[model samples]
Target: MPIIQFQLIPHTTQDGLPYQHLRFQITTEDGLMEPQDLKGLKLPENVQWSQGIVIEGKGPIWLYGYLVHECHPSSWVGCYDPRLGIVVVSSHTHAVKVGNVLPIQLPA
Candidate 1:
């Protein structure tokens, strides 16, 4: 299962809003219960919850995690330039999987 979390960004808009991020993490966490067992999981109690973006959609998040473990670098994400590799990493946190195809952008 992915470790869900958020990052804080300062807003420069008129009202200075708080930008909250949702991370359906594909972390280096050693072992997790099967995706089926995450249990329609509502996020935990007393943890920081985002009021910024509402996540909506139906799809396999954890299953995508499984597929990343099997795909190649350029197959999933279109861009895989070696020269841009370092630049790409600086842009986002790399997906921690058993393979090279980084899943930086998650399923919507």
Candidate 2:
């Protein structure tokens, strides 16, 4: 259960339209990145279901989104944006801050 932490970077969709749904580009300190295709991505249960409104378009969709983002056994993950509620782990191509606080999962 090696947990690896990363940051979530928000971006506009390809169409340049900003729709709902937590979107991000995952990245790591060692330069490891991956696409969090929820369809096949084996992320934590907390990261999966907490995407949008439980009823989906029912009560009130989340303004930003989940925070924990997404993850896989690869040790990649994201967290609730302390700034924005936007969830969805990202893998962007930016130099991970020199000392960004991140979570570290234990080895299984």
Candidate 3:
């Protein structure tokens, strides 16, 4: 498996703290699915989605915090890191199992 890197220039807060984005894609048995199709898909636990996506110390450490923030589907108003990874699809939008798959969307 290869690591799909999403180049995210960390957002500088007014306080000068850098906030990184967590972008990743889910890997099914077939391969990495299209980001648009992720909204309503099912992913097994054995799926190799992380692979080389997350390389510790390679980028900003705050990306983990962004991942945690994005994981919560209730807050559907945040920016989706245009990377290859999972997303939090809200039950309010579709009839999907909340944890079925992570939402992956390319930046528009």
lDDT (0 to 1) per candidate: 0.29, 0.28, 0.34
Minimal lDDT window, size 10, model 1: 84-93
lDDT of 1 by residue, 1-108 (tens): 334332222221123323222223333364344566444544323322322221212235564343223222221212222332111111111332222332223222
Stronger candidate by TM-score (2 vs 3): 3
Tell me how candidate 2 scores on lDDT.
0.28
Cα lDDT of model 2 by residue, 8-98, tens digit? 2233223342222333333334534233422343322333322221101111122113232322221223333334332334433242221
Q: Estimate each model's TM-score.
A: 0.25, 0.18, 0.21
**Best-performing candidate as measured by TM-score:** 1
TM-score for candidate 3, residues paired by index: 0.21
lDDT of 3 at 75: 26
lDDT of 2 at 97: 26
Of 1 and 2, which scores higher on TM-score? Answer: 1
Question: Candidate 2: where are CA atoms >4 Å away?
Answer: 19-108
Report the C-alpha displacement of residue 107, candidate 3, in angstroms: 2.6
2 or 3, greater by lDDT: 3
Which stretches of candidate 1 lie above 4 Å from their native place?
Answer: 1-16, 27-34, 40-50, 54-108
- The TM-score measured for candidate 2 stands at 0.18
Please list the residue runs of candidate 3 whose C-alpha ends up more than 4 Å from where it truly belongs after superposition. 1-61, 70-73, 76-85, 89-98, 102-105
